[model samples]
Target: MNEIAVKSNPRRQRLLQRVRMEIHAELEAARLQLQQRADYHPTWDYFLNLLMRPLAPDRLQAEVGPSGETFMQFGTV
Candidate 1:
């Protein structure tokens, strides 16, 4: 059927509503899964990473270029 005929039909409208509800349910389920992932806790290895420091924090330097843009330079050289 043509677009206008399908759109005006009650059966077509019902079918569209059913498909819409199914897609909405899938979207909601996906959102709930993402929400659960967001609430997840990190492992012990994550905390262990915080205890380690850079090998040469003092060697890090920050300076502005001719264009007035700041950038970092690592190492004494």
Candidate 2:
């Protein structure tokens, strides 16, 4: 059996963290703006829930190809 070790890049990790924080901040701002609308509807809560849901995985998975090359699998945000 062959064992594959997945290594994470520090730079990429930091970048991802920054991006996630920015996204969350933007979502919160949008949510607040929507709530302040004069005609806010309860049905909009469903959409807000979807927007507030987790956008992406904290860490990406590294897969080894048949040729022994490792690549990252980025998840949807």
Q: Which candidate is the best by lDDT?
A: 2
lDDT (C-alpha, whole model) for all candidates: 0.53, 0.70
In candidate 2, list every pair of residues with a backbone clash: none
- What TM-score does each of the candidates earn? 0.41, 0.54
Could you give candidate 1's per-residue lDDT for residues 1-77 as a string of tens digits?
35537567887777777776776566556545654775555563343333321222222356465589986655575
Residue 57 of model 1, lDDT score: 29
**Tens digits of per-residue lDDT for model 2 on 10-69?**
666677678888988888888999988999998999888756754434334565655899
lDDT of 1: 0.53
Please report, as a residue range, the 10-residue window in candidate 1 with the lowest summed lDDT: 50-59
Least accurate 10 contiguous residues by lDDT in model 2: 1-10
Identify the runs in model 2 with alpha carbons over 4 angstroms from their true place. 1-7, 54-77
Clashes of each: 0, 0
